[model samples]
Each structure stands twice: as structure tokens, then as C-alpha cells.
Target chain A: MKSSVRNQFEGTIKAIVRGEAVSEIDVETAAGIMSSIITTRSMEEMGLKVGDKVTAAVKATAVFVEKA
Target chain B: MKSSVRNQFEGTIKAIVRGEAVSEIDVETAAGIMSSIITTRSMEEMGLKVGDKVTAAVKATAVFVEKA
Candidate 1:
């Protein structure tokens, strides 16, 4: 689906940490490792596994850039 | 503070949409505009305004990467 949210990075799954409700996923991008949290159900629905190619999409609102 | 969360982007604030509880923030990076949703209180605490430089940090658990 089309979205206003930007910052999409194509990467490979580096790791997955399953929790009770949320699952932590790490994507290795050229820039660095992009981390994400999603519901375990979504993780199961996606059938995500290590070495899989995925795109990390972040909404501008969810991004917090620190001043430097 | 140190964090395990990765995918930090250095960028400038593009826009901010203040809502009753949550606020939408947009950061312009070389890659694109990274959108983020933060609490209005956090926004105020950060004293975030347009044209400010900030780093967008995303926890691996909070990020969702879709397989393609």
C-alpha cells in the first residue's frame, strides 16, 4: 500500500528475538543494522526468518532524530 | 544515554504536526524524509521545532520490515 511514511531501507534479516507479545527484528543495511519491533502474530504472518530480504519502513512521526 | 536501538539517522526537522496527544515529526535525510510519531509531552521535552538537527533512533522491535 502507498504510504506517506518514508525512510525505507532494503536489508537482510540479521536476527530475531521473540518475546511474549512483541518480536525484535534486526535488519542489516549498508548504513547499519536497523532494528524493529512487531507483534509476534505479524512476525508469524510474515514468516520472517534470518537471511530474508526485507524493507524497513518508518513513519516520520516514529523517528526521533537527536540534535548534533 | 546508551541504547541498544539502532538505525539512527542524522537529519533536519522538516515538519511537525501537533495533535492532542501524539505529534508527528518529519526529518529530511539524504535517504528521505523519516517520519515519527511521538508523544506531545516528549516533543515538548525535546523542545523540537522546525529546522532543528536530530537523530532518529528506532528500536529493532519497533521497526517492521516487509519481505519482498
Candidate 2:
């Protein structure tokens, strides 16, 4: 899914779903767009907060980023 | 932009683009799919490494994840 449009946004962590040690960040961007839920086990490692500045860099490609 | 096909994959960080403090992770998933470039300044915060296992949770929505 390669799109010339590099979708990027910055917002606050409207919500956080704590799964095990990993956490899902729900950032609210401009308009009514709910950015994808980013999964990370270490929020402190990423210095992420409920109202911290962050950017989601989406690449234009089709690749599954999961575990076995 | 909601996609029932929640595209998720697991791979290694083939490349890393250092922009200031942020780093772009290029994870190589199954087939020839180059997963999106995830940007993060504190990789240790996310416990991400060059050969560390990671998952990209892509939400089917259109909300820019950038900075202002």
C-alpha cells in the first residue's frame, strides 16, 4: 500500500490500553481522524505520555509487522 | 479509513533513518512487504532494536500523525 501521501500526525494519547506490558496509544489528530493504535510495551522507554508530543511515521508499503 | 484487513506483520528493522532524535524503523515483513516507517526518538523506551521483534498496529482510519 504505497501512497505518495506520507500520512503523518501529532496528537495526545487520548487513551491507553494496557495489554500485558505493552500499551496501545490512541492519538487524536486534526479533524475527526483516529490515528492507528500504536503498540508498544514500554511507554517510558518511548517517553510517551497521555499528553506528550509524538509523531507516527507511516511508510508506504504492505508488510505485516507482527509476531509468530 | 477502516480496513477489516488489519494488516499486521513481524520482522526486523532492515533500516533506520535518524532524523534529529527520532529514528525511522524499516521492518521487513513476509514476502516483499516493507512495513511502514515508524518514527521514534527513544527506541529504548519502546524496547526496539535492530533485530528485536516488533509489531505495527495499523488502524483503518485517516488521521495525520505528524507534528505541528
The per-prediction tally of clashing pairs is: 26, 18
Candidate 1 regions with alpha-carbon error over 4 angstroms: B11-33, B36-54
Q: How close is candidate 2 to the true structure, as a TM-score?
A: 0.39
* Runs of candidate 2 exceeding 4 Å displacement: A1-5, A33-39, A62-68, B1-68
TM-score of each: 0.66, 0.39
lDDT of each: 0.79, 0.50
DockQ of every candidate structure:
0.51, 0.14
Interface RMSD of 2: 10.8
Candidate 1 lDDT over residue span A1-68, tens digit each: 77665668788999999988988888887657788888989989999999999998876555665665
At residue A15, candidate 1 shows an lDDT of 95
**Strongest candidate by TM-score:** 1
lDDT of 1 by residue, B1-68 (tens): 88765778777898999998998888776556678888899889889999998887775545677877
**Candidate 2 CAPRI level:** incorrect
The stretch of ten residues in a row with the least summed lDDT in candidate 2 chain B is: B59-68
